[model samples]
Target: MSARGFAQAEYEARLTRAQALMSKAGLGGLLLTTEPEIRYFTGFLTRFWESPSRPWFLIVPAAGDPVAVIPSIGAALMGRTWITDIRTWPAPRPGDDGVSLLAATLDEVAEGPVGIPSGPETHLRMPQADFARLRAKTARFLRDDAGITARLRAVKSGAEIDRIAHACRIAARAFARVPEIAAPGMPLSQVFRRFQMLLLEEGADWVPYLAGGAGPLGYADVISPADDRPLARGDVLMLDTGALWDGYFCDYDRNFAMGTPDPRVLSAHDRLLGAAQAGLEAAQPGARACDVHAAMARICGADEGAGRLGHGLGMQLTEGLSLTAADRTVLEPGMVITLEPGVETGGGNILVHEENVVIRQGGAQILSPWADTLARLA
Candidate 1:
């Protein structure tokens, strides 16, 4: 199965760190409900989360191992983890769900405020009605976890960085073979479909996200779904993907020219590469996220108008901090982020370049195979 999850000691260290932070925040316990939060503490990884029929809960106490209060459907997998105290009930119980068991457990474990992740980018996976019932069943006040989860997830461990780098390597191999599936007269949609197959062939566990565009000048936007338009001699093709390896994602993209691209587009692509290089140099420990964004922004000028230039990446395709003029989040060692820069190429289109990188003590380390110039196709 794409490598057995992390070692037991890894989870132990995570729990110890979380408990220390919880105690300092004056929290009796933490109530985790989302997939990332639950998987972060326990090594319980499952595709059953896609069903969304049952809710999963993990309670991180002030001093010990986390308690997994999950559905019976997941007990076997949860048992495989390091957790010993597990509580389960037949899930989808209409009126109660797991609310009664969950609340009672909360009452027994938490004496002070129960911390829930209520900060930006956080989510409550359970139903709203059940959450209200849970609140009524327990006397504990549900307060924000004070960004504790985000703080810990922002900086990855050595093991996590290895997985991310592995994912990047898989993607890099797929990108190198793009010429085998792409050429003039080929449909853009087919290229997208074939690129996904290449990712799997190159050893990606899964490809959860892929986005790109093609145009005679540049694409109108990056997020638009691929159409049936066939590539022309003058077209500029870009493929951006978020491919996974053992649940870690590598998010970056490549630009290519069909036959011969416009001179303006080629110049814009080179400038985009230059801007990304600028971002790489600025990504250093103690530097704010905006500092890196400003460096790239200086070169892209007013062309990089697709919101932020880049964002943090790891477990999810995009997470934690952002590279924007307004975000002052400090960069730190072991934090993986993307350097994406773009520029206008006349009309309403734009040319962009992106690369995955991890902040290190020396500077920044490139995770994706670095590209200096635009690749061409006949």
Candidate 2:
């Protein structure tokens, strides 16, 4: 049971909450196709999602245990989950995938309106053509789920928070070892590869996302995919990673100077730190996401160009609410988010700093070990 990411009670509670919401929305069942939503209901975790060869589906009914309508290959894994009513077919059947079986199951479980996650950050994993076929085969219309999954997933359980925090600790440990592998003359690309190894060495199950840049003043962009540029004395190297641990992710970054730091770079780094602090402080349970963005933007200056200062992260690297002026999602206790602040250095370069935190009753609690100083490498 410890090996599983969450207990059975967690899944039960999720289903109960979702069913309650479904009843109010006049929904008979909820259709889930994507990895996160399925795993949210059932603890089916697998890297097999890497292959798009087959499609999978989970049906959350209005009053009973969710059903797994998946390929034969996944029946064994789905059995490990709390789900019992497993339905399967030989996948990739060319003209007739799982549409007939899926339509039948949907008809049996759902009465009137079956809801599908139709909000931002949600998508149907099945082929569009198959989905059209499914719609034609089934009697009930698949409508929007009224943001039930998003709202429920926004506030995590304590068990979920612990997993995320474990991932953060792994990334922080790997960051501390950066000096051992980085210095002047190291190619930025090699640095990226070696840093991922460090993350695995520390404890990450896998390093799904690692992007960074190196420049004199600052990196032009934080999402740089690492070129062959070498580190220099005044260069500021930034590495942002999305490392996973037990299906949870820790998303943050660290900045380090190659040898000697430039005065301008130091000033920009200090401002980023201050802005991150402000954002963290403003992430109280009742504050809106835009409020967090505004607090950090004030310190980074009003005309910052990085778009979003930070975003929510959990099973997926970026989900839920975003820390931007346009997002007004209220911060709730147990909502995990990142406070990333950036400042424009000269020549279109920007210095960005990020920290992972969870909204608590009083304020945001830092999951990653907080830092105030910019690190330097020999």
Candidate 3:
């Protein structure tokens, strides 16, 4: 499992790649506190971050291996990773929680400006007061290196792609059992619970996100939690999940009708599938992200007020690259992204179809089982 999750070489390669980017950006080192970024360099994987009571820190110098400065509870786990120099302190303390230690570590490792992710979709995972204190201590060496990290992580390795594909496969198997587990008159909340259990049984490490809606025309929103509304014949039901395998995530959704769907719903599903096809055809190694968006938008219509059609997926639920008209990030081989096309189906409702794929030299290789037709669950 350790080899499958990540070998020593994988971590070393990641660290080397990060150091090269830091060199190009003139950064002395990188200070990472986010869960994904920390795990990217070291093979430290744990669900302990859900508590958020203690902050963990990893410092990657421009030359050597990473150093982990974290709470005492995580020392054992961090010891198991490729990282050797581990620093720990009692966490959740009233005032001085690891700030001084982190400052000293940063000062020792980095001489010039140090990089931290401060751009889009990134968050500082520690207490604001602690951050303020750390900033005051190391004020002279701070810079935004979100782009440096983003560019390095956007393109995945073969192992990373396999992990993501395994996650996608787990979710797909769970989706296949929805027909067996769901029935008319069952509450949507119950469906969510049952489906999550199925995902776990089908080999998912966890189901971090599982949300969707059910309506006659479709659902008004896709991100809302499951409700007590009972399924009825002709209601279109959707379930979007972010399932994890090892530490990688698969972001995709599936749709089902209680009985026979409306002709229009079927037509909309067809259009969404066609849009995915167009997007897949355009997902070449050198194609811009906007090109993929435009190809899909041409089939799904440009009025999708659902923001970006899709986005990068791997370590987090959503990563750096976004498929939109404005984003110009070039697609590269080994980048795993979702092609999600949502269509407004009148009555203030919409239908969203999603599929995960890896950009290969040839084209987009589908990871999840293809939804050839809109499923009608009896």
Candidate 1 per-residue lDDT over residues 1-378, each given as its tens digit:
256589989888888888889889999899999888998888787768898899999999887678889999899999998899999999878788899899998888777898999988898999998899999998888999988988999999888999999999999999999999999889999999999999999998889899999988879999988899898888999999999887789999999998788999988988898899999999999999999999999988745468888998988899999888999999999999999888889899988888999999999999999998889988
Q: Write the per-residue lDDT of candidate 3 for residues 1-378, one digit (tens) a residue.
A: 234567789888888888888888898889899999899898789999899789999988888888899999999989988789999999878578999999988888886798998988888898888888999987447789847777778899999998999999899999999998788899999999999999999999899988889988889887899889899989989999999988999999999988988887888999999998898899999999999999999989755568889999999999988899999999889999999998888889889999999999898899988888898898
In lDDT terms, how accurate is model 1? 0.90
Go through the candidates in order and give each one's C-alpha lDDT.
Answer: 0.90, 0.91, 0.89
Return the clash pairs for model 1, or none: none
Candidate 1 has what TM-score?
0.97
Q: In model 2, how many backbone clashes occur?
A: 0
Candidate 2 whole-model C-alpha lDDT, 0 to 1:
0.91
Rate residue 101 of model 3 by lDDT: 91
Query: What is model 3's C-alpha RMSD?
Result: 1.4
Which is the leading candidate under lDDT?
Answer: 2
Where model 2 places Cα greater than 4 Å from the true spot, the runs are 1-3, 302-305
Model 1 ranges off by over 4 Å: 1-3, 302-305
